[model samples]
Every structure is written in C-alpha cells, then in structure tokens.
Target: MEQANIQMTEPGVSRADLAKLLAQALGNEKASDVVQKAASKLGIRRDPLDKGQALSVLEQIAQTPGLVGITARFAKSRLHLR
Candidate 1:
C-alpha cells in the first residue's frame, strides 16, 4: 500500500471493544476480519498493531461503504487498549 508509513495515536479502545463497535457498525461478526484484512493488506505479520499500522488499517476501513462516518467517529474518539 502507498500509505504504508502512516502514523497513529494509540486509541482508548481495546481489541474487544473495537471489535464490538465495528460489529455494531457493520452488523456482523466481521470486525476482527476487517482488522485482519487491513493488517494483511498492510503486510503486517504480527499481533497487536503498531501505532502507524492501526491508523493505516482504520484508514482502509474508513473507505469501505457506509463506514466513513462510523470510522470518523471512532478515529475522532480515543480508543481503549486491550
């Protein structure tokens, strides 16, 4: 991805919470899947995203249909760390 070096602030939401929010937003059991896909797309072969990777993943997610506003709200707010 061209935006590989994105920088990110650690959010206040934990993995579970983030998944919960994403599940709610997407209305399915695919929040974690989304994260994984983004991570894979970014070529991240590890658990617990580094700050930049997290932002990059979120940025990718934001581009999905119906997710811009939801992701904006999440990105705008502090997410809890797991």
Candidate 2:
C-alpha cells in the first residue's frame, strides 16, 4: 500500500478530529486509549495535542508492525496529511 509521507512538522488533522475518526473505526473507548498509547510511545508530553504532536503520534501508529499498523496506515490515508 502507498502511504502518504507526512512530515512531523506539517500540519495535519486536529486531535479531536483524529479521535473522532478512530472512535468510528475502533469504538469510542478505544480511540482515546490508542491515541494515548501512541502519544506516550512518541514522547508527546500533553493532552489535547497540538497538530504536530498528533501527526507524530499518527505516524508512529502507521509504522507499528502488525494488523494494527495496517489499519492505522489505511486510516492515516483518509486524513488530510498536508
């Protein structure tokens, strides 16, 4: 699959927007948990993440090696990665 190369510094989707999409994909409760885990793994130091941090976390998720990563990469493509 061809994934968009989103730069860490580039502005992407908002945290709330990403959470909403994730909620739709993985259920309401799992959304926050996924973001938290991704953020924690990426060393993001805040809640209500800034766009860059959110993108960083999303990128981390996309790189994860498993079915989750495949799902995440597919979802990442749906986001505005500009």
Candidate 3:
C-alpha cells in the first residue's frame, strides 16, 4: 500500500477542537479530571495537547508495532490532512 502524508494543520478544524476530539475518541474529557485517567490508561502523556501536537502524537503512536491498526480506524476524512 502507498503511504499517505498527513498534514498537522487543517483549514477548518481548530487545534483545540482536534485535541478535544482525540480525547473523546479515546474515552476522555477535554481539560478535565477524566483526561488524566483516560490518558494514563492509553499510556500517553498527560499534558494538554493542541491540534497540531495531537496529530504529531498520533502519527508517532501509529508507528508502534501494535498501534497502527487501531489508529488507522480513527482516521476520518473530515480530520485527515490534505
């Protein structure tokens, strides 16, 4: 399969919104107590993430031996890089 390039920036999706989406997708709240729990469960950093950062983090995680399959399922067109 050919590789797809994902841009970290989107013209319509705000950075904060992307962060929130990822949090929800992983079963967490945005900038709330539940975020800590959800992040810990996912074994990712607990720091607040903006849209671009969230994309970068996701890309890195997708490269892991077991994470790509699961992450790919979350790659929707509305949020994909152009």
Candidate 4:
C-alpha cells in the first residue's frame, strides 16, 4: 500500500492562525462553519481551540477528498512544522 504524505503542523499553533489558514484555503465565509462542523465531528470543544485540537481539525480537513482536502493540504503546508 502506498502511504500518504501527511504533513503535521507545529505544536502551540494559535487558533487565529489556524482560522486564517482555513479561510485562505477554503474561503472567508465558509471557514467558520467548516471549523465548527469539523470540531463537532471530531468531538473537540469549541471556544479557543488548543494546539492539538487545532492540528486535529486541520488534519481532518486535509484527509477529506476533493478540493477541500487539496486546499487544506496546501494551507497546512504553510504552517511551520519544525
């Protein structure tokens, strides 16, 4: 089986940064809804997502198939992992 190239974001990533990246990747109007749904689905609490939770949301979107996933991967890449 071919392993997928999953890129991980750095720890301590701020919520604002993640939200900005998602907005850039998807769109300004849709980012909030998407994050809300993703967090709910992932069982993550709302209001100020911690580093791990934010990363999880990013990874979830990244794994989604189609433009959403592709764009998320691109956005995820912009984050500093090291």
Leading candidate by lDDT: 4
Per-residue lDDT for 7 in model 1? 88
Model 2 poorest ten-residue lDDT run: 9-18
For candidate 3, the lDDT comes to 0.44
lDDT rank order: 4, 2, 1, 3
Cα lDDT for residue 73, candidate 4: 76
* Number of the candidate with higher lDDT, 3 or 4: 4
Candidate 1 on 1-82: residue-level lDDT in tens? 5768778765443444445556765644678777667667878775565555566667676677776447534752544333
On a 0 to 100 scale, what is the lDDT of residue 30 in model 1?
76
In order, the Cα lDDT scores of the candidates are 0.60, 0.68, 0.44, 0.71
- In candidate 1, stretches whose alpha carbon ends up further than 4 angstroms from where it belongs are 1-18, 80-82
Top of the candidates by TM-score: 4
Global fold similarity of model 1 (TM-score): 0.56
- Write one digit per residue (lDDT tens) for candidate 4, span 1-82: 9999999864465555666787875777677666667778899776576666776787788888887777677766666352
Which ranges of candidate 4 are over 4 A from the true structure?
1-16
Q: Backbone clashes in each candidate structure, one number apiece?
A: 7, 0, 0, 0
Candidate 3 per-residue C-alpha lDDT over 1-82 given as tens digits, one digit per residue, 9 for 90 to 100:
9989977653443434544544544433432333343345556563555445455544544444443324423643334553
- TM-score of each prediction: 0.56, 0.61, 0.32, 0.66
